[model samples]
Target chain A: MFQPEAGKTHLLNRMSIKIITYLSQAPASTDEICHTLAVKFQLTSDAAFLRNIDNTLHHFDALGLIKKVK
Target chain B: MTDKKEHKQAQIEQQLALKASEDSLSKNKRRRLLKGAVALPVIMTLHSGAALARTSNMIGDAPAVDAQVDMEGRLLCAHPDPTQPQIAGGPYDLGMMPSGHYEKQIDGNGPISLDNQAINCRAGGGVVISGVAYTSIMSRSGFNIM
Candidate 1:
């Protein structure tokens, strides 16, 4: 995916694709996204996995792909 | 009997091969998926100048907090747990020491001897500021204090 604001291109893997897809549908917190993705992908939803999702969300926020809700 | 032994050996070999293949495939697939998922910012920026400028200017201004007064009585409980009520004796103040100085005292306690290491809020020892007794929630030798 190409981010025009950052002038950078990203290779979206299956997990990232799922994250963006979920965010596109509705606004959700880190825990909400983690839980939803865990159930969808049959993942363990451990701390490390949750941290990965948080990092991805932060990256998207930096690129202006997603906005943090007040 | 010879034929029976040969049949059993073939069955065992086939099962081992099947298990090995399944393990290798699953391990490889999971490893690749997780690697790509966690390792982000994979590609190069098309416009380095713009990206660099944006990054450089991300933080417009940062107000200095060292000079600010910590009026919250946070000194009483450094890491307050919501479940536990605030330390008694309200209207706490930082006393004569400036906020920055007080913060430093709390942050760095040169070298806490083993005797001082046992002194903590739970142990009933506290610091007195402006004649108000406030239990320092953290331990002097604990990792929390830098």
Candidate 2:
């Protein structure tokens, strides 16, 4: 298992890469993604998780890795 | 058995690829059709459907915000969907925001009875005023004339 010794920004980038890979398969809403993440990572709090996913999506959108279906 | 599984996966992949292509085509067609449906001038003049109420370009004139001007041009006051989640203490609180509203041009190039005469639509034709994607040189953050 690869352990990340880097700080929050690096962790965020790695998480965003995972997000982009998942989204490459199909478009998903923030809620749907957070639920999946929470289940996979065993995290809690859907609403707060949504905010993090939303922010990451915003960055991905700016980078043109994904586009809003709507 | 492994070969059979690979073939099955290939078939599913083919189907997914076909579906994705169909979706992309449909979205493109819808966007093109929507472009044609709205009046070209309205499309050009106003870009911000909601944030357009703040027309800082007009010197003394209050921005004309009917927000919901009917393309059918009917005089109907469209009340935004009540169930739609709104920004609390914002436009929703005022009951002034529309679900969607076209931005109106702030001024014309004619000598009008307004305090600041610099901005007007009298001389320009088809020159886009509203819905500008570029940052205004005269805006306050850059420059606020109004």
| C-alpha local distance difference test of each model | 0.46, 0.40
lDDT of 2 by residue, B1-146 (tens): 69999999999999999999999999999999998865332101111123322222221112223211224322212122354333332222112222222223233764222222112221211111222211321232332121
Q: Candidate 1's residue-wise lDDT over A4-56, tens digit each?
A: 34545566788887777676666677777888899999999999998898798
Model 2 lDDT, residue A27, Cα = 60
Error of 1 at A38 (Å): 0.6
Best by lDDT, which number?
1
**Which parts of model 2 are misplaced by more than 4 Å?**
A1-12, B1-146
As for candidate 1, its clashing pairs are none
TM-score of chain A of each: 0.85, 0.71
